[model samples]
Target: MKVLLVTQYFSPENFKSNDIAFELAKRGYDIDVLTGIPNYPEGKYYKGFGLFRKRVEKINGVRVYRSFQFSRGQNKQWRLALNYLSFAFFASIWALFLSLFKHYDCVIVHAPSPIIQALPGILVKKIQRIPLYLWVLDLWPEAMQSGGGIQNKRILTTIENIVKFIYTNSTNILISSEEFRIPILKKGNYNEKIEYFPNWSEDLLFMRQDFDIPALPKGFIIMLAGNLGKSQDLDAVLKAAMEMKNSNNIKWVLIGDGSKKSWIDDAIVKKDLQDNVFTLGRFPFEYMPTFFKSADALLITLSGEYPDLKLVVPARLQSYMAAGRPVLAMIDGAGADLIHKANCGYSVKSGDYISLARIIRDKVFSDLETFEKLGLNGRKYFEKHFQKNKCINHLCKIIDSK
Candidate 1:
C-alpha cells in the first residue's frame, strides 16, 4: 500500500508523527511525508538548513519532502498563525501536484489546524479519489480556545467552520480519547465516523526493563517530559515541589522545552528551589527511554480546567508507562481516567499543588514498597495494552475498514 502522511512537522525534527511514518515504511508500506523546515517550539530554522533551499531526501527508507514555511518562535500571535498558514499553503500546493502523478491508496493526515494541510487530501479524494484518513491528535478550534491561544472571535468562528467541513467530508476520523468524540458530535452533527484510536508506546522505549532505580540517588525522582507550553499547567508541579521541599527526599525534573521554560526558570529562582528542581531542555527523541528508565515516577500536567480541555490524551503518558514507571498526573478528564484505570499512578486535582504535594509525600515517603508496586503495575499495564504491534495493527484495521 502507498500512503502519504501529511503533517507540518516531520523527521530529523522531534515529533511522534515522524516515527510513525518511518515505522510504517519499515513494515513494507510505501510512505511519503510532506512537511516544513525543522523549526519547532523554538521557531528558528535548524542549524544546517538554509532559508530558501527545500530538499527532498530519503531517510531510513521513507521519502520525505520539505518545503518553505515560516518557523515558529517567541513572537506575536499573528506571526505564529502566519507560520502555520504558510506551511499549510505551500504544503497543500506541493501535495496537490505530487498527487497528480503518483498512485496512492490512502492519505493519512496528522493533526493540522484550520483544517489546512488536509486540503491536499481533500483535493486528492476529489481528483484521483482515494480514502483520506484524518488522525486527529487534537480537535481544532476547540484545542485553541481551551489553550487560551485563540481569542479573535471572527477567526475562531472561521476555524470552527473549517473543522466542521473537514470532519463532514472525511472518510473516517481517528481520535485518541472518547472525550474528543463527544465534542465533535455535539458541535458538528458528525455522522458517527469517529474511531477511538489510542496512542502507543514505542516498543523499544517503553516496556518492562530491569534497571537499577537505587543507583541514581537516595531521593525519589519524579519527571515531567514533553513540551512545556501554555497548555501545560506545570506551575502546579512547581508548587507541589515547594510544598514538599522540607519533606523526604523528592526531586522534580522537567525535560523538554517550550514557551514556558523561562517562566519556569523564573519561578524556580523565586522559590529558591535550586536543590530539588532540574531542567534538561530539548534532548534527542531517541534518548527519552533512558530518562523514563531513570526516573522513579513520571509527571503529566495540563494548564487549564476548561470542560473541553479535559478530553486531551497526552502522548507522553504512554512513554511513561512503557518504562514501567508510575505516573503522577495533575490532569483532568480522560487522561486522569486512564491513570486511574491502570492503577499505575496518582491523579490529583487538575491544578491543585497542595493536594499534589501531599499525594507525592504520602505515596513516596509513607510507603516506599507501595510506590514500587505502582511503578511495576504501570509497566504491566503497558505490556497488556500499548505495544507497538497493537498500535500499527489497529491503524491497519482502520484503513482497511475505511
Candidate 2:
C-alpha cells in the first residue's frame, strides 16, 4: 500500500510524524512524506537546506518531499501564524499537482498544529479520493488559545470551524490519547470512527543504556527536557528548584530551547539559583537517553489554563518512561490520569510548585527502594502499552479494517 504522510514539521526537526512514517515504512508500506523544510520551534532553516519551492531527500528508506515556505520562530506570534499559513498555501499547491500525477491508497496527516496544514491535507484527500486519517497530536484553537499564546477569539472560532470540517470529512480520526477523542466527537458527527492510538517513542535508542556516566550527588536528579513554551508552566519547576536549592543531592536541570529560555535565565539569576538549577540548551535528540537514564526522576509540567488540553500526552513523556526513569508530573487531565493508572509516578497539583517541591524532596531523598521500583514500573508500563511495533500494528489494523 502507498501512504502519503503529511505534516508541516518532520524529522531532523524532532516531530513525532517522522517516527510514525518510518515505522510504517518498516512494515513494507511505500511511504512518502510531504513536509516543509526542516524549521520548527526555533523556525530557522536547517543547515544545507536552501529556501526553495521544493526539495527531495531519502532518509532511513523513506522518500521525503520537502517544500519551501517562509520560516519564523514561535517567539513572534504573527510571524508564526504566517509561517504555518505559508506552508499550507505552498504545500497545498505542490501536493495537488503531486497527487494528480501519483496514485496513493491512503493519506495520513499528523495534526500537531491543525490550522497550519489542514488546508493542504484536506485538499489532497479530496483530490486523490483516498482514505484520510487525521492523526492528531494536539487539538486546534484550544491548543492555540492555551499553548500558541493566541488570544484572538474570532480567529480561534475560525480555526475551530476548520477542525470540525476536517473531522467530519476524514474517514478516520486517530488521537494520541482517549481524552482527545471526546472533543472531536462533540464537535463532529463521527464518533464511531474516532480511534485512540497513543504515540510510541523510538524505544531502541531511548531504552536504558549501560553506559556509566559520572554520578551526581547522593540524592536523585529531577530533570525536565524539551521546549519550555507557554503551554508548559516551567516557572513552577523553577519555583520547586528554589525551595530545594539548599539540598546538596537534589538537582534540577531544565534542558532545551524555546522563547522562554531568556525568561528562565533571568528568573534563575533573580532567584540566586545558579548552583541548584542548570539549563542545558538544545542537546541533540540522540543524547536524550543519556540524560534520561542519569536522572532519578523526570519532570513534566502543563499550564492549567486550558481544560481541553487534558486530551493529549506530551510525546516526551514516553521517552522518559522508556528510559526506565520515574516521572514526576505537575500536570492535570489525561497525563495525570495515565500516571495514576500506571502507578509509575506521583502527581502534584497542576502548576503548584510548593506541592511539587515537597513531592520531589520526598521521592528523590526519602526512599531509594521505592524510587527504583517506580522507575521499573514506568519501563514495564512502556513495554505493556507503548512499544513502537504495537502502535504501528494498531495503525495498520485500522487502515486494513477500514
lDDT of each: 0.78, 0.80
Instruction: Give the best candidate by lDDT.
Output: 2
Error of 1 at 101 (Å): 1.9
Off by over 4 Å in 1: 51-54, 112-115, 204-218
* Runs off by more than 4 Å, candidate 2: 204-219, 362-364
Q: Write the per-residue lDDT of candidate 2 for residues 1-402, one digit (tens) a residue.
A: 988888888878887787778888888889999999877766888877767533888888898888777787758878887888888888998798878888888888888875458667788789877788888888887888787767888988888888888887788888899987777777877887788889887784444565444444345577898987777887888888877777656778887888888999999899998777778787777677887867878888888878766667888888777888788998888888888888888887778888887776666567867877887888889998999888889899987765
- Residue 41 C-alpha lDDT in model 2: 66
lDDT of 2: 0.80
Task: Encode model 1's per-residue lDDT on 8-43: one tens digit a residue.
Answer: 878667666776787788788899888788877678
- What pairs collide in candidate 1? 43-72, 206-322, 207-322, 233-303
Candidate 2 weakest lDDT stretch, 10 residues: 210-219
Candidate 2 versus the native: TM-score? 0.94
Steric clash pairs (candidate 2): none
